[model samples]
Target: MRKIAASLAVLVATTTPASAQNAVDWFGVDGLEFASPATSFRFTDLDLRDPHVFLPITIAPFPTICFDFTDNAIPTTTVSFNGNIQASYNSDSSPADGFLDASSLLWFRPLAQDGRVARVDNGGADCLAPAPTSGCAPSATAVATAYAYASFAAGTCLSSLPGTQGSPAYAPAIASPAGSCFVTAPKTFVFDNNGTPLTLIDAQIAASFNGVPATALSNGLLRGFLRESDANQIVISDPALPGGSVTLAGPAGRRQRQLFHAQRQGHAPGRERLVVLFQLQRVPGDLHRPLSAFGDHVRFTEDTR
Candidate 1:
């Protein structure tokens, strides 16, 4: 009887499917919310049309930005590509700490291709003329790339607990560390000699989350602060003059804003939904020819499924 039992156990182990052993179930859909005011600078004689010819241009900040994770699953291990996920525990020290990680891509496009150049002249000669133009006729555009980083406590905020959403439960709050998750520093060279180069837009961004709830709640609320530094710059390559470039730098301006996220009720197991409201909170800074007032506000929703 013992030999028969051993044979049965061996058969069952061998017949188990590989997929069942490695199956991973992720929580809800991941998302993002972003917005900023309008700011800019100007450059003269870009095309060398005249000695003091000037053109006014505006900077392109993300007025509304979001990412969708509808087709992807939150991974249990570190992943790279369309999305990424990471988790770790600090076991060496007392009061062990846990972490949940996620990241997404950020991109900036020219506000308006046709409007990039406020105005241009050929120094009384057609710009397309073969070789008889009097002065330089300059044109410019901007581009940029960035990413968003967020980390949460795995054991506290993202843990699996039953009958906790309806109860008055609180989890440990998480805040952004003192390092930039998104940076466009040392300047990205757009429109270089390299084939298909991107335009560059320099922006200093600061973000944080406050009063975050540790656990899911039907009426959970959190405050978010997003600030764009005044020291923004734009770099454009001069196609007319090979190896030549133009840079637009401006003084400190303000575009401080608050974002709100409300937790959804009746969430499924391992899934949560959040609705975010985006709005401008403040606009205080110098307004010169290049810098304009803030634009419209935006809002959106995010889900974890």
Candidate 2:
């Protein structure tokens, strides 16, 4: 009788489930916003033939805007906006790469702007004319608000069991031979307040798993958001209502390679490159929704190149 009681007690203890921890809210009540630090302008002076001498041209600053929507208890997503205007003069025909040429003069202009909003003017004087005597009639052209929703294949928890010889783990683990966590859901997007979806041309997220224990991964993860230095891409898809999709493949779409390099130096030897292919589509009249619905596929592979 004593042995039977002991056995029953052990079975109950082993079968009792582990209470799940509260979901880590990377996004707070108010979503986050990322804007360009500053705007820059480049000017060049070209000595034209005789009368057409000392032509002044300006290159506008390239600005990047981003918004994150991790507040929802469901899927997570993000949106990004970026644009630039470049101009240059080719005197020697040696392939002008849009950089400041030694024989050319470059001028820089700084503009104070917000990433959450976009501003443009119509029906204005030609600022680029040979001689401009009046300022252009500036007006607000368009405005938009963007955000993202993401879901991990291994749920929100940071740890998972180690992978087998043929199939490795997708979520990070505490012990040796950690597994990787993939973004199971598509990175959804939403444009709010009668905003044009095309106002945002590109979006991406950079995640780093630097040997930090699973419990601590979500502590300060918000601060790890990617910035301008991560080499982002521009949207090339045709403009459509509600939303559209674009794919970033090959060298043009690569991101956060340096983080993988650092991990290779001393961290776990697990695969570093996690490829997440996103296909974005409009939610149709669901402007209130934080992000549109779409499908995503993830893969763990080596650098083929």
Model 2, span 148-222: residue lDDT tens: 222232322222212211123222211211122211111222212112221111222212122322211111110
Mind giving the per-residue lDDT tens digits that candidate 1 earns over 4-65? 11111100000112222211122231212233322211111011000011112233663432
User: Once superposed on the true structure, which residue ranges of model 1 sit more than 4 Å away at CA?
Assistant: 1-32, 38-140, 151-305
- Which 10 successive residues of model 1 have the least lDDT summed? 6-15
How many clashes would you count in candidate 1?
16
Model 2, residue 45: distance off in Å is 13
Best by lDDT: 2
Listed per candidate, the RMSD to the true structure in angstroms reads: 28.4, 25.4
For candidate 1, give the lDDT.
Answer: 0.17
Counting clashing residue pairs in each candidate, in order, gives 16, 15
Alpha carbon lDDT at 65, candidate 1 = 23
CA lDDT of each prediction against the hidden true structure: 0.17, 0.18
lDDT of 2: 0.18
RMSD, model 2, all Cα superposed?
25.4
